[model samples]
Target: MASEPQYRALFLGAGPQMQCGVGQFTRLLGEWIEKAEPGSCTTLTLTRSEGSFTEIWGAVGSARSVVCNFPIVAWKRVMFTPLLAMAMARLRRRKTVLIQHEWAGLHWLRRITYIPALLLANTIVMFSPLVRRELAEDSLVGWTAKKCVLAPLPPNIEAPAGMAASDLRRRLVAARQDGRLVIGHFGSIYPAKQPNALLEIGAILKQRGLRPLIVYVGSFIRGTDNVEEEFHARATELGIADDVIVSGFVASDHEVFGLFGAVDGFCYPLDEGLTARRSSVLACVQAGRPLIVTGPALPDEFDHHARFKELIDRGAIVLVPRGSSADAYADGIVAALKRPPVQAAFDFDGWWQDVANAVRAQL
Candidate 1:
């Protein structure tokens, strides 16, 4: 109730409407806060308009907490900054935390506007080492490190029960019977995601007489220069267009999980520049799907990578070196496909409990 102030927290960054890493980070934080301290905390999310802030607001009202999910472009010469600063000042007397999820300083002016709000917060949470490293590189972390804490993004949904290894192998065999080796990727299509690499891998597979079906699931954000179309065109140019299937944005979790379950292997060939920890890899791990992730080296704290490597040492996920060519990555996939699938004993509930403890300690 407003009569007794709750531990107010403001999640500031673009959100799921933007369908980017930051958006996913904010959404997960909101979930963790609610689940951890139910009825004891209030959340306010500031994101872009495309983000369904209002929809999330309707879901969580002003009773136990208020969801102030609003869109304000910081670079604009609007009065939003003054309004936000005023709001932050008013909420300062309450137990408040401001969480910034963005790693890139896209608009220098926008960073200038948002920096003060972050500095004034009781605590600042960085979702990954990449985020912290970015801040440090920009001298932002020096200003906020005492208040900064590293908390990687959690999976948006709980891991689902996966099909047994026997069932998955049988399905893969059936898919192969169609003369296609199922290779897939999920999440929003962006240049940073490197969809072209998938096309390259498809070409390589075809060269080896292995028909490759590259499936992409997720929609593109509006006005990002239509990178998805470019990817499709490039796939065609690569001579593997017929093998590519771009199924844009499956809405249901079951559909997404099913897609992952049916695939032979998943690819995440992210370019090195865009470095924020990803939850997609976590989803793959939870689904018990084999993976081929490409980016700068992942932090040791990533549970899936650690577990996958452990399993590899124990003869589980087939681990290959980074920068391995499409052929090498394909080899890893083939090896993984042939091996027996062994699901890791992930403690999802325990993971949430750890998150709860972190929030409690902060409070």
Candidate 2:
């Protein structure tokens, strides 16, 4: 075999040990990039609140020596804008790619502090066109759009295993003794994630004669652990406590994929519209389960993305308006259930290849 071409690229982001979505993305994407271009890609993990800015500077300086040296230095976490600004000033000779994960994190109060740093970066990678548009509307940062790259977030988890990989499917089926359809919501629970909407969906389904069990496959966000308790309380108030299942954080991606296989469909309701930054959405797509996503308006750009449009064309994802009446939500779910499993439409590996190419091209 031709020796894997050697190249080195620097990544500044959270590592796998951080246990958060950005960290997971950084870890998995870095590994995938290296696999695609062997011996390429080095990462300088971001400092948690516990570490000093000076310490991070030391790490960045050390990582710059790697030969996969490219003109672009990609930074994944935008929350560290100040540090990013300082780093950019020091590494002025190199280009930078700033990947923004959350729309809210770009709030003026927080963002204003880093506006100068953001504009200085070579490329602004926004996960969704809406976010990119929103950023463009901002007077201080709108000009950054000249260099913005719209790369949809790709699924990062291992592909879903065959039914024989686990007994989860059988167990879920058995749990639904009355032929209940179990709908799942994966990823950490947070207000924006809309776990409460699942209750409304379940109630609507029940009234329509299809028993629905809402399963939460991930844990509540830290500092909001009580959110799970509140969910149960709300479910009880709605008189469907037994139908709601909360499975705290699962460590193994295989098990996570197994849970995805167990569900009849994956329901994600978010106010932000289905953006590319959502790894949970990516997970559902990889699971190949019918997807029901409730969000605000679907941007025209979404249709422009060939990959996402293909997923929709294959009946893999169904979009419902955010805050739609329970009847509307229930109707979407029923329609999604009638669709067959999308076994072959997804291009999981192709996404990694694209990511690798982008990194190389930028470098």
Top-TM-score candidate index: 2
Among residues 3 or more apart in sequence or in different chains, the pairs in candidate 1 whose N, CA or C atoms overlap within 3 Å are: 17-51
Q: Write the per-residue lDDT of candidate 2 for residues 273-359, one digit (tens) a residue.
A: 676566677777787788888653545646435676667667777878766777887888888778666787567788766665655
- What range of 10 consecutive residues in model 2 has the weakest lDDT sum? 65-74
| Model 2 CA lDDT for position 361 | 59
CA error at residue 362 for candidate 1, angstroms: 2.6
Query: lDDT at 208 for candidate 1?
Result: 85
- Give the CA lDDT, 0 to 100, for residue 278 in model 1: 59
Q: What TM-score does model 2 achieve against the real structure? A: 0.79
Q: Which residue ranges in model 2 land beyond 4 Å of their true spot? A: 1-8, 13-16, 46-92, 105-120, 139-143, 160-171, 223-230, 295-298, 321-323
Q: Write down the lDDT of every candidate, Cα atoms only.
A: 0.57, 0.64
| Per-model RMSD to reference | 6.3, 5.7
